[model samples]
Target: MSLRISDAVVWQETGEGISLYHTETGDFRTLNETGSKIWLAVAGGGGAQPVASALSREFAGTDPALIKRIVADVHAFIGTMVDQGLFEESPA
Candidate 1:
């Protein structure tokens, strides 16, 4: 699967993090540093696995279990974004 930012959503980078606004629903979300990175990767057409792998490498020397957790977290993040209508998923 591939991910893309929703057309209805607009985002901006702030000193604290990234802010997302949903035009249709008037919903708003803020992502911290890590989440901002994941959002960028997904917005750049990355899938869950690739994003997770890149994150794992960035945190090199992390425990194996933690790496697995990161993978799970990335998947969960993507799911939540889709559910929140912040992202659109498509078959690759």
Candidate 2:
């Protein structure tokens, strides 16, 4: 599945981490290191597959199993963000 970043959401990078603000719902979320990377990948307008591929290349020492696990984790995290109305969902 692909992710669609909501237009109503505003994201900012702070010294601590990245913050995501939902204007429509008046909610906020903070992303840690891994989350920040996933958020950046999604916000870059690429989908899950592309994000997985990017992660694979970036962490060269990661085994295939670990890469897959990370991809699954990213997908789950994206699902939560979508459920919270932080982004739109585009199935692929």
Candidate 3:
């Protein structure tokens, strides 16, 4: 149930940030700032926990509970994208 970026797809930074396109489904998503950051991190080939840790450091002032909350939110967001086939887990 983890969400990860699809390595097989190609992304283009457009006028409004970036959009990811899946040639298979012809589905694309335009990302806002937070989404863009997370997308870049996943595209860079790091797993979820590392991204969460990086997010905690980037935001700062986030206590443990808040960090967990943010991580949960991130998971939810990514989960939705994955469910929609915007992302896929890497092969083991």
Top candidate (lDDT):
1
Q: How high is the lDDT of residue 73 in model 1?
A: 88
Best-to-worst ranking by lDDT:
1, 2, 3
RMSD of 3: 2.7
- Kindly list the per-residue Cα lDDT of model 2 for residues 7-85, writing each as its tens digit: 9999998876789889999998888987888888888887877887787667745688877777777678877888889
Compare candidates 1 and 2 on lDDT and give the better one: 1
lDDT by residue for model 3 (12-91), tens:
77777678888788876798988888878877775666777788667755587877787887777677767777778655
How many clashes does the backbone of model 2 have? 0
Q: Report lDDT per candidate.
A: 0.88, 0.81, 0.74
Clashing pairs in 3: none
User: Candidate 2: which stretches are off by over 4 Å?
Assistant: 60-62
lDDT of 1 by residue, 1-92 (tens): 88899999999889878899999999988999999999989878898789989997787457898888888888898899899899898888
Better of 1 and 3 by TM-score: 1
| lDDT, model 1, position 24 | 92
